[model samples]
Target chain A: MNRFAGPDGNIETEIQKSLLNIDGGIMNILSTVIRKTILTVSFVSLLPVITLTVSAQELNALVWCDHADDKLLKPFEEMHNVKVNIKTYEGTGAALSIIEQSAPGDWDVLVVDAPDAPTVAGLGLLEPYDASTLPMSDLFPQLTEAPFNYLDGKRYTIPEKFGYYGVAYNKDKVDPEDMKTAEVMWNPKYKGRVAVYDYYFPTMQLVAISMGISPDNITADDLEEIRKRLLEMKPNIKMVGDIVSVQNALVNGDVDIILNAAEFVVSGLMPTLPSLDWNIFEEGGLMWIQGLSIFKDSKNKDLALEFVKYVVSPEGQSRLATSECYWAMPANSTTQLSDAEREILRWDEQPGYLARSVPSTISRPEIDAKMLDIWTEFLQK
Target chain B: MAKESKSLKPLHIDYTRWAFHPALWFTICFFIFPLAVMLAISFWQRVYGRLSATWDVANYVKFFGSDYLIDSLTNSIEVTVLTTVISILLAYPLAYILAFKVPKRIQGILLLVAVMPFWTAYVVRSYSWLLVISENGILNVFLKGIGLIDQPLEMAYGQGATVLGFVHFFTMLITLTIYANLVQIKSSYWKAAADLGAGPVRIFFRVTLPLSVPGIVVGAFISFVIAIGDYITPQILGGGTDILIPQAIMLQISRAANFPMASVMAVTLMAVVVLVYAISAKHMKMERV
Candidate 1:
């Protein structure tokens, strides 16, 4: 600068120095922005893996298809920061077979038939639980400390969901008044327009009710009368199906009436097909209560217990009631439901329905075997 | 000298023979071993949910004693026989057309088009048939629009519906098999028969039909075995008006957890298939090609 510039301060040199300073500042800003962008991208990419690694712990349960819905599981997942693994089964027999084939500690929870609670616990598969930890005060009162929840005087399970097995029909296609009686099942007017539920326990219980016998007191001697009635109803039925198939048959106009239908079938379809509806028959209906129990070999018992508590809570009950797989009445009386949902589920009529309904109980092995035999014969006939 | 000659036998070996025995051992370990377990279980008793190994033949006795249960066997055989005969009658002509009438250049495309329905899920295919034939289904809707009938016909969910579902699937299988056999029949054989003063009808019965007996028997035997053992078609399409043996077996396993009884039913089914195989093996050797 001394050799090329004049005393008055060389303007060219000054301008060059200012320009270089500005360029250097710009370069510094660009490097900082690039570094931050890479860091943010990397952190965002690894979040799920980090979450999974930290919450690698999972609670495994054997449940029905209703528990497969994410709306019922997501809030709990977010709260506990844990994964829930579930396997669905059709009946208690299928559930037992699955558990027998699994290794110890492979399952953390079980959702079994309420009547099967004692029998299942007797096998030493479920652990005894303290009753006071749960919000028992919020339950329907009859569900808490009920005979079905105890085994040898120890509390082992709690009712989570319950509904009645009865009939659903297209109100316009079939007379709503005729549906109140079980005798309507075999009426010639509805011939080739009826769908029977394929399940034996409840269907047989419905038949027992029609025979003036209680499902809880069914004996080997009563099976013949039930068999005759079922055979008489066979020709009137167009199909025998599970919950979904029978529901489809009714909604698609293939059948006008469904015997052994429950709220699980008609709840979801009510919005689209306003004609779909259900009611307990005057002859009688069997009430089914599904309960949740902890496994003795659960490695994640603490988390599993938390999950059970969540499942019976008001918010959780609302979610489970409207689960995507199907819907049933929540066991919690204080469950949150809109006015419309309450109307659809017939909330106001539950007291009368509950009083008239019989628990879906079964007989001892010998009598049960006889009942199944008669049921098989009825299917063939 | 005798010791030296015995020592120098050159160790003759066959590598292919070594593999054959291992494959047989593998089959025995996987298939025969499970069958043996099932046989042992059939004698056991299931009281409540517990499995008791006390040996007895009560399950087999029940199968033979109960008329309703035994009737499932008769239903299975009747349904399967009718399905096999109907499929053969339907598939043979279509197979003949494809093999002889269709040009060879377009044969591959035509075969693909023919079997296109089978490319769907097995369960979905049965449901598709149900949708087409149900009371409110496409056919009924189309017919009702044209004033063909006042009431919708009951064409779905019965023994007839089950037969229709089975025939729809098995016809593809039988057609493929018969088409293979038909193509293998040389045109020169038909020419020789024509030159021998044999009319078309005589040539058909004497030459064409007799040569294809193995194909028909093989297809029919396969159809009989599979259709008899299947549970889905009868359960879905038979409308619970009738029970098949597999449905009865499922009732035991699915709800009762009575493996002993289920195994008895399964073994009885195996015996029936074996009897059919024994009868068919006299004339049709499926492996003789």
Candidate 2:
């Protein structure tokens, strides 16, 4: 044992010191490696979640079945990587109620008819859309300066589609030449053989126009006169419903003529029922445009603005026009359409002719929200 | 010493007796409490896009004030009375045949046939009736083919159509109820009356008819209650002219967004049903005695 031991007792103490030093060094190196690895993994894991959280802002889009195209939204979603929840309401009243209830933050983008735009913008629910930020030079002059969008030199909504309400008649029952004017609808020659929209707004407005009342200065007395005229023509109406049902009734010969039907409804029925003919009234018809507006309190303001641009863009508007044969006059002037497409879209180039053909009129007083109770009372009675 | 001895003795009590008992308090909390809340809200005013806590009776006042509301209420009562009478008349014979004439093995099959329409969706059954009653439908075609009439009659939107639809849909349940009560009566009672030289009509009036009063009352009560609240058949088949209580309530809620008015109508309906149930229960008990 003495031989195996070190030469001095201090030898054991020196070896112990050496071992402790090596052990401390190894532990320090291992801790440093572990800290770096953990930091690296945590940093990598957080990138996607942080990006997603930032992109998870609220989105609002107004949708109506068979009206709003769903395909145009895909590119916007891919670019922004955010959820675009579209809320589709059935009727005009339901849509108005949605905007009234959830104003500012309720919807990010709204597709409202041109007549409703003034009322909606007047309520301060829509923000002033800065057309200068987008390619405004490419838009049509009429669309850019449309009275519906321009209020006090500030534009609130941009026109996406334009159409007209006209009379669609069954050629088998009604001669095309005989149904050229609005007065034909009121003529007693078609008693119990014609139909009109059930809503009083369109019916009353058309009646007012035929009665020679200026569309701009329609009053309560004017409305009463229109109502009386309508009641007198009640014997002519076989049935009254929306455009689709009216078209079906026309094709089936259940009704000879339908007043206030959209151009698209008549055109769509033309292929199936070859006898159907659509004619614009010479007294003037409603040249309506549906415009898109951004909600005031939208969380996804930038995304919503991008959506509006996409809708008014040549490609987006053209896509809508081609698919549904929608009477969409593209806002973008740069877009070129084929002759067939132009005919189908019903493009009206001459400003004076277009103006005289489809008269731009204010919405009826019956559509005023304050007078809804009165309207319902009259309807129920 | 007595206290020490009582402590030493073991106490025995059965804690398992309540294992099958229902929780009455739980039922009251969930079911009864919500109904009470609805009744309370019915008496209040709705303001500023929300219900106000103010107790205003204007909703009730409006319901009673309008001739429209009064007319709908009267129509509902009239329809209920007519439906009850028709159901009873149709259900009594079918119930009698099922309980007395039919064989034991075949009775189940016959009862199934009676309740077959109930197995199908009510709307689908109602719609089938619509097709049968439409202008160009089978009934008109047959009637015209047989030279009964030159033109198709307008039968779709009227009170007659609505009452017919209700009776077609509800007769099965009435038959089943009457049959159930009829089967429970012992045949020996009728046998005993017949052996005493009583005729068929006499025995029916004396024994079978009196014994079956319970089923008649229950069937009539159920038919009346259902017919009073029904609005869909009336709305679709009765056209725009028929405005029942439920339709008025629905119009107020959906078209007008007037929840207080709808609630008031609902509360009135509930009161009528409760009064009817109370009267029926009293009459049933009196007859039993």
Best by DockQ: 1
lDDT per residue, candidate 2, B119-144, as tens digits?
A: 87766665566567766567878899
Candidate 2 chain A TM-score vs. reference chain A: 0.71
Winner by TM-score: 1
* Docking class for candidate 1: acceptable
lDDT of 2: 0.68
Write down the worst ten-residue block by lDDT for model 2 chain B: B280-289
> What would the per-residue lDDT of candidate 1 be over residues A1-381, giving only the tens digit for each residue?
565555666977665555558957655676788999999989999997888899998889899889998988888999998999899997787898999999999999999988889989999999999877777887876666568789889988988988888988998998899899988877898988999888887888888888788887877788888888888897788888767668767766789998887687898888777788899988776788889999999999899999999999999999888887788889998998988788778877877787787677656787777777887887785
Cα lDDT tens digits for candidate 1, B34-66: 999999999999987689998999988998899
Work out the TM-score per prediction. 0.88, 0.66
lDDT score of residue B148 within candidate 2: 100
